[model samples]
Target: MAATSHPINLEVDNETLAGTLLAPQQRMPGVLFVHGWGGSQARDMQRGRHIAGLGCVCLTFDMRGHEKTLQYRQSVTREQNLQDILAAYDRLIQHPATDPERIAVIGTSYGGYLAAILTALRPVRWLAMRVPALYWDEQWDTPKQQLERARLMEYRNSRVAPETNRALSACAAFSGDVLIVESEHDEHVPHATIMSYRAAFQRSHSMTHRIIDGADHSLSSERCQQAYTDILTSWVSEMVIGDRIGHLN
Candidate 1:
């Protein structure tokens, strides 16, 4: 089926975030796509469009400091990015075509980090994270100099940060379904961090953890990219849309 796509420009605080909305003719489950850090909405557009073709409403957007608003890169903060993410979620859920109760959030890398926090903050039914980046609240919110200095220090108790705790708490409280995609050769996110994320979702009614072999953090190759998109679309179609597509994970 053909899908319709719309350009979206969101006004968040002092900067503008670029986004796109894709939808089928009929209203269905809603899915929001959050791109990784240093990435734009375009990175997820193909997956969003394909999901829309499967009768789902999808929204994909560029976070602050990324894509069209590169000028804001220097000023955008972790807090600001969180605000942007919340605003984007609100926009998607409020749309006339979206069914708020059946919503899925898909994010990659840093975006996946936000998605993890969001599932706790909002009533997200389905959650998907790919190679989610890890950060401590203190380090993430600190100045670049301080953050760099802290990064260079010992790796003692990395998972005890306030923000990480909050996300883990949120995930623990969420009783929906979760899908975690890991890269076999991911250089940014470590296996330990991925395991931590998986552990956080202990309360999820269903969880699917899949790894794409020979794939980098970005799934740079065409073959890996196709696998990423297929895994995501196929799972959402089955769990969210109730279609017997095929096995995922």
Candidate 2:
């Protein structure tokens, strides 16, 4: 079936967010796409369209202070970013074509970090994160700092900035299916950061991970991008659509 897409504007507390919605011909599970820092929904648009073609409603939106919302960047806060993601989730679930209880979320980099945080806050059934960058309270923290703090008497989890703490806490509690993708040749988001996130998902029921060799943080090459797309689509097929179909049959 052919897929259709349309522009959407989401209203938050005091700002408006711009995004796009891709819908398949039939009602099915919904997928929300969150782009990385400094990126707009454009980065995820193609992926959204492709995923929607596979019978899921997909949403790709620009984060605050990005693309259409560039003017608001200076005023955006970490708390606001969290709010944006929540708002997007709410909007997607409310769509007439969406299955509220069956939803998937895909985020990359900073967006990946946010997606991880969302799982604890929302009823996300499937989650995929590509090179999810770690932050402590929205501020980048060195692995050494995280490690040193853990070694100290101070509770590492509690000592983290509020946002980071919330995400970590949520990840610790979430028991859903998850996919964590790493870039083998990436220069950003070091190995320690990756492991830090891996450690938090101790309770995830099904955790799958992959490393895209020869890919940088952005998966710049055409081959790398295609590999990333394939990985995500395959996971969505198995974890989202396959599971839904299995229940019916």
Candidate 3:
């Protein structure tokens, strides 16, 4: 029989390539994105997609009073909205590709407040909050829309203790990585509100704080929106990649 020339070149393969091929498939991390009150999942879709590209299972859902549930906006209570968050978290963790142990939650404004409380009820490895809003604990069962806006603003302007607030209390007990982003000129969530959150994460494994210069509460300008997105994605990337590397090593 005549000898045939081999089409494959085994000599070109490297140890790194071989190792990668032999490595076991890892379960992906799960990420849950919670949009602020008056916002819907649409706002977080892009960010979720970007993070999903980094090998995570990302989920974004509207709370009870938003989007499809707009009819409930006038009557939705904080308790009901919290239930929405818990349901979303459960759905994400139940995803087939998710690594339940390495879950992350990213929330903005009112959403951030609920995300913090979520940690107390579930397992969260990383948390990212942008202009997390603070509210009094007394009105837990009251309809969110019925709350006094001026009262909320005044409360947010003052310093709050971890022991006195449900969200802050949860933050006080969290031992995972955290990223707190603040808008330099946010009218809805003042600097004091951010400071209160920052101080509450006393036991976090690591905490990063960033201020988007000249950004307002709503991020009305495109520049401000982009800045916030950049800061959030960068932090999430570092945390997710570092955690994966640690697991592999």
Candidate 4:
């Protein structure tokens, strides 16, 4: 997969945020890639490459507490990031190359949390979440410990309850199939925690979950990463194929 990235910043309530746009060698669809807590990184960049390789455009943006947003926020919370995501979603939907009906949102950790919160808002065709930070449900610890758990690979069961419940309350209003790929040994979000969120919603008449055994929150294993890519591609395929069928019908 070959991709060239361009740096750009977008405006949200007067603050300019940082981001990168990745276009594939071949054009296919559009993907909005959101980073975890710290913002941009090799992992996110690689994800962009993979999405671009699949012929999709990838856009990654910084939230308020992200490197760019950090300097601007008086305090941070999931609610605050939700607004940023709302803006980001709007921006992507309006981009010249993006077909609002064909766009998908992929978020990691905190970004995943944002994606969950926004799924209720519109035609989000598919969702791919990696080591989603259940911070809202779990105890808030040093960012270091959380990152460590995510990087060292401790995902097992989801204990991410508080936020998941909120996300659950908002999900029925969302329209689309959802996919969540979490770690099996993750310390940050024990499997039980995330499942609590699921308990509230009916399984997608068509949805699946895969556990990256022994993997932690970050989904750091090369094999797991590949699995993640496959899941995302397959979901995208479903989205496109389903849309085609809907249009024809």
List model 3 lDDT by residue over 74-149, tens digit each.
Answer: 9989998887777778766766677899999999999999999999999999999999999999989999999999
Query: lDDT per prediction?
Result: 0.79, 0.79, 0.82, 0.65
Q: Top lDDT: which candidate number? A: 3
Q: What is the TM-score of each candidate against the true structure?
A: 0.89, 0.86, 0.89, 0.76
Q: Write the per-residue lDDT of candidate 1 for residues 40-138, one digit (tens) a residue.
A: 887689888888887788999888777787777776777778888898889988777788888899989878888888887788989999888766655
Write down the lDDT that model 2 would get. Answer: 0.79
Give the worst 10-residue stretch by lDDT in candidate 3: 15-24
Q: Which ten residues in a row have the lowest lDDT in candidate 4?
A: 137-146
> How many clashing pairs in candidate 3?
0
Ranking by TM-score: 1, 3, 2, 4
After aligning candidate 1 to the native by TM-score, how far in Å is the CA of 81 from where it should be? 0.7
Name the TM-score of candidate 3.
Answer: 0.89
* Per-residue lDDT over 1-249 for candidate 4, one digit per residue giving the tens place of the 0 to 100 score: 577788877787677777777875554467887778765545666767766766677787778776755764445655556766787777766656566776778887777766866777756767767766543434332333333455323432444333345565544444456667778777566666567545544644445566777778776688877877777777766766676677799
Stretches of model 3 off by over 4 angstroms after superposition: 1-26
Candidate 4 displacement at residue 224 in angstroms: 3.3
